[model samples]
Target: MIRLPASIRAACVLAVVSALAACANRAPTQFYTLLAPAEATPVPAESGYAIELLPVVVPEQVDVPQLVLRSGSGALQPVDTRRWAAPLGEELRTALSARLSARLGVRDVYRLASPASLPLYRVRVRVGRFDSVPADYALLDAGWSVERRDDRSVRTCDARYREDVGAGIDALVAGHQQALARLADDIAATLRRFDAGGCPDTRT
Candidate 1:
C-alpha cells in the first residue's frame, strides 16, 4: 500500500460519506398499488334479460397509458416505477366488468372484440378529466352516451364525481371506481327506460 497524504485521505473519506448521504436522501422508487373502492356493491338484475357491456370506446382525449398522480404541491407523478400499460382501455374494461358484475347478476361483459352476437346494449364514454385535486381528493368528469343495437338515437349523459382519500395513486384509483359506478348506474337506468318502452325506436 502506498502512503497517502492526510488531506487526500480526509477528502476521500468525505467523498465516500457524501455519496452515501446522497443515496440516503433520495426517495426509493415508488410503485403503483390499487386500493379497492369501499362503496362497491353488486347490482341485482332488475330485468330477467341479461346485458353485456360492449367494448368501451375510450376517446383519444382520455387515452393515456398511465394514470398520472399529482402531488399536493401540483407535481405530476407516475403510477408505477415501471412504465404503465398502454391505452388504459383494458383497465377501464376490467373495472366496469367488476362493477357491473357486482351490481347486476351478470358477468358477461366483454371487450368490443368479443365474438358475441347477443342483444346487448353498448356504452360509449368520453372521459374529459381524471385527475387528483387539491385537498387530498380525486376528480373525474365524463360525458357518456348509450345506444341499443341497430338504433340511431343515443341517450347522452354527463356527470362529475369525486373521491376523498389520502394522496397518491390510491386516491385516483378509488375515484375512478366511484365515477365508473355512477356511470354504470346512469347507463342502467337508461337501459331500463328503453326496455320499458316496448322496444320503441327512440333513436335520437
Candidate 2:
C-alpha cells in the first residue's frame, strides 16, 4: 500500500471538495424548442389529406443538439448551456410536422402503423441552411419534394424563409417557428395545386 503524507492528503481532499462545489454551483442547462402546442385546427374545406413527412436532413454545421448561433462575422457558435429538446434535425421535423399538419389539417403518419387507408403524400425536406442571428433574423433555406403515394407524381422545389427576430432565446425560437409556418403554407399550397397545374415558382 502506498501512503501519502498528511499535507498531500489534505490537499487532495481540498481539491476534490472544490471540484464538487464548482459542479454544484454551475448553472443548469436550459432547453429550447421550435414547437408550439398542437391544437385542433379546422380541416380545410376543399378536402382532407394525410402527409408522411420524412426525417428532415439538417446542415452538418447545425446538426447538433446545441443551438447554433451565427455571429455578425459569419462564424457559427454552439451554445452548450442552451440546447434543443432533441437533435436539431429531429426538432426541425417535429416543428414542421406539427405546423404542416395544422395548416393543412392533415395527419402526419410518418411512423404510424397501418396508414394505408387515407391518401398520403410523402414529403421529404433537406435543409441547406438554418441561420440564427440573435435579435436580427432566423433564416431557413430548404429544398423539399412531395410525391403522391398512389400515382407516384412528384414535385421538387426550393424555398427560403426569413423572419426578423427580437432579443432573447425565446424570440429567436419564435422566429424560427414563423419561418416554419411559412414553409408549411407553401407546402400546403403545393399539395392544393398538385392535381390542377404545374408547380408555382413562389418565393418567401
Q: Write down the TM-score of every candidate.
A: 0.59, 0.80
The best candidate by TM-score is 2
lDDT tens string, model 1, 138-174?
A: 6666666656655555667677666665333444456
Taking the candidates one at a time, how many backbone clashes does each contain?
Answer: 8, 0
Please provide, for model 2 over 70-176, each residue's C-alpha lDDT reduced to its tens digit, 9 standing for 90 to 100: 76557676766678999988888998887776677688888885366778889999999999876567899988889998999898888999887665667888889
Candidate 1 yields a Cα-based lDDT of 0.53
lDDT of each: 0.53, 0.77
Which runs in model 1 stand beyond 4 Å of their true positions? 1-46, 50-52, 55-65, 71-87, 107-118, 150-152, 195-204
- Best lDDT among the predictions, by candidate number: 2
